[model samples]
Target: MRRIKKTQIAEMLLEHQLITKEQLETAIAQQKTSDKKIGQILVDLGYVEENKFLELLARQLEIPFVDLKSYTLQPDLVKLLPEFYARHFRAIVLKREGDAYLIGMADPQNLLAYDEFERILKAKINTALIREDDLLTILDAMYRRSEEISHFAESLSAELKPSDIDIFSGTQDFSSDDMPVVNLLRSIFEDAVQINASDIHIEPGEKVLRIRLRVDGVLQEQIVEEKAITQALVQRVKLMSGLNIAEKRLPQDGRFSIKVKDKFLDVRVSTMPIQYGESVVMRLLDQSADILRLNQIGMPKEIFEYYSQLLTASYGLLLIVGPTGSGKTTTLYASLNELNKAEDKIITVEDPVEYRLPRINQVQVHSQIGLTFANVLRSVLRQDPDIIMIGELRDQETMEIALRSAMTGHLVLATLHTNDTISSMTRLLDMGAEGYLVASVLRAVIAQRLVRRICMKCITDATLSPPEITWLKSLKHNEYLNVNYKHGTGCTYCHRTGYLGRIGVYELLPMVPELADALRQQDSNKFQLLAEKQPLYRPLVLAGMDLATRGITTVQEIIRMSGEI
Candidate 1:
């Protein structure tokens, strides 16, 4: 038997805190009986936590304990680490392009090493296993020089400009000159997928071209350049959507698909000719956004619980009312996800299906084919759907059909363009939907708005001025409670805007017997009065005020959007 060093024994005892001499002796005795590692013996003898042992081992070995699960390794960084470290640590460098590196390592079974690595790196590492072939493919895909990849992206973008896009679409009829345009169109579609845009909008102005992308329900400007490039980009988009390039005078619609990031996204493109040039809107259908859970949406508990109950109901028209860009689609999509199951048949009629939901049949409303909202709703009824989701109820025909579907037993979830729940009813009445029908068939109406959240890192306590304090005090009858406004201190985390992300301020109109009776009698005044009296009925202004009171959002946001509390 080899003699263990006294210093090594002391260190182990000190580190493991096998503080008792008897426990250390027991561990030593156990190590002799078990072929298991000495560290295992100490751990089994109630010595130290597994992580602590691993941390010690990492310090002894002078190597990183990698947990690949939480951390993302850029491709360039992988190339910077020594190859010996990669091989010894059993890591495969997936991508080592230019200055970026993406590395994948085996599970960090050595807890000590992982702790040390975490302390040193200050970033979490995510771990996952990959096949050798897949790893090799990733490595091969890495560009030697980042500039090459960047330039290729730039060139593809250049070719996608409005003028070039126009030329390409114009020449797609198989003329020898049309080859460049065909190639250019293919390249732009490929690039659009890489950037993860939900929709692409190409609007032509008098002297400028604007390309906007709808990402996560908000429109973001992707590119703004000269008109020629914008036209080319539009033409390229039209060609991919399978529209006639020369038919720019009339509105055209088309769709195409591209594989990106190991997933397929459907892109729907719409173009209308404006005075300057053709305007285009491309809607990207990324399924991931639709798969979000209800809790992930960040609504307050009251609103979330209220909506949850409304959705579980068997039948009723649950209308999500909001202005454009208020995340109504996301809320509707989340509700559909909640209702979707193996047993139920869910059908949706979207002007164009924006996102694909698995296990649900989505019908696209084609105005050209006379497959408008009314036609689709009529057709969806025959499909035996348990739930029907109309994208938007623009006119009387669609509104009536949707209401009939809900009244007859189908759960209808849809969006309407309005400022609040009350306004939605008025708008529906103005659109030719009978007032009584609107009252009876309506289950609940949710009106929502987005307000920026105070950046946690830069949030500060601020004393409110007399006017602000007076307004806040007016919110409740109890003027005795002390309250102060929270404002952002401005930091890099919040882009110096003092806000990091947006939270939803929701107003839910819960359907009660009294409210339903008022709607049935076409009594708008009674309905409003009842709504105000309900404890759960939170108007948009009150919701905004609640958010401001909690310091989750600022008073100014509430004032600007929903008016003073």
Candidate 2:
């Protein structure tokens, strides 16, 4: 393909009328003072759309234009060019033709890069024009050292054979520093940390062992062909967690801490006997990760303000209600972090203390020794505490004591396993707490669920389907029908899933006189009606939909999260 000269780029744009002459003059003036390329300057200065200009340039240069958003490239081929060359030239290795390699470059006019690549790689080069942003996405995603994980897995498969099985002995000690099982496990942990995964699953199958990582609330699997290696891997994990390696008949739970790639991770392990073999799951919590402040979490403005006000109260019960893995504990911790002060004494009683706060006192629940939540909380009340945080409302006794503590002038924050704010009232009533007590000291309820955020690297315009429009209309959300929405096209950056991380969706319900009256009367229907009538009250579905309208999440995610709402 013929190359377009860099000097003629502006002239061609002028001939094609893609940019006004005044705009070109402005970009030229800015180009003199900045190190940026003229094409990038034009795009940055709003003189031309990036993809449109790149497509036209490709046509003029007689090169193919490729969209790498949903494109899959071989990892081996991508590694041919060093990371330094990939970033310096803004290029990616696409594929190999018989004697030449096809290279995608944002600036195909840079003939110097072509010459250097051909000289170093000893092959002819073919050029394809790609968007600069897409090039950046590919560069960051491709260099995550995923091939090293695959190589480690392959080595483990080759090293361990069927004769290595020793399930009866329940122990296979490896004194060698070059053990493949150890290397594979370490590589898997490093990869999981790099990808921000929450859980790792190692399962034994009839033919192979499957390894899966839970990222952004979804599971991504990797298969290991060696079934004999499962026993060794399980033993290693058991040993690290300080569990009995011989007792594989019953389920067991244990925890351990490790440093992977300079990040401290707390792993919770659970083992179960399955049909094939033992299924092991590891939940990873980054101990070194910064705790999110109240404002940093994704709370809407009005709700955040109201909840902040509740935290300032001298004494009341503030409950965070959600199911498992809905981020209830995170919200509770953030609130405590907001209220942590020298003048106020704060204490928490958790079954297993997940995080350690600097000034706040934390108690762990140990039922075997009679140190349950209720027992510990009853004792903590006599210590002249100003603020109290309970990890969970596990029983009726604990529920009643927490309410009494709130009524007796102590700010108590706790979490409940309920669907929404209103159901929490019913739960307390069902737990045998007096309705009057529940009504007197209850300040607010914060219900939350986590939804995956779209990958910003590959976000694009999206149109709502007919069914989605109908659903929104049924909810009286007609304002969203014409709004411009966005979604992510599958990309390597998000593992081809179009979502990178998770964000919280909140439903804040503050107590009012009318709602309290309904609660006291044990009338849940009346309480819900009055709560929904409040100006600041929005259900979980509405909150999630608002995020979808702003392109923070997708409509499908809102629907998926609102199954109970």
Choose the strongest candidate by lDDT. Answer: 2
The regions of model 1 sitting more than 4 angstroms off are: 1-227, 454-500, 563-565
Candidate 1, residue 131: the lDDT equals: 28
Give the alpha carbon lDDT tens digit for every residue of 1-565 in model 2: 7756667889988888989889988998998999998888999988898878888889889998988886657666888998889999999898999999999998887888988899867999998998888788777766645556666667776776566665434456666633777787898898798789999999999888889999988888877676777888888898889888888889888999999998999898999988787899999988898889999888888989999999999999999999988999889889988999999999999967888889999998989899999999989998889999999999999999999999999999999999998888898899999988888999999899999999997888887888877877877767777778888887778866888789999988888899889988999899988988988888899888899989999987887897856
Tens digit of per-residue lDDT, candidate 1, span 122-231: 45544323322333333333332222333433454554435444532454333333444455444444545544445667677765555565533345453334455555
- Pairs that clash in candidate 2: none
Q: Each candidate: RMSD to true structure?
A: 11.2, 5.8
lDDT computed for candidate 1: 0.66
Residue 47 CA error for candidate 1 (Å)? 28
Residue 538, candidate 2: Cα error in Å is 1.0
Candidate 1, residue 23: Cα displacement in angstroms equals 33
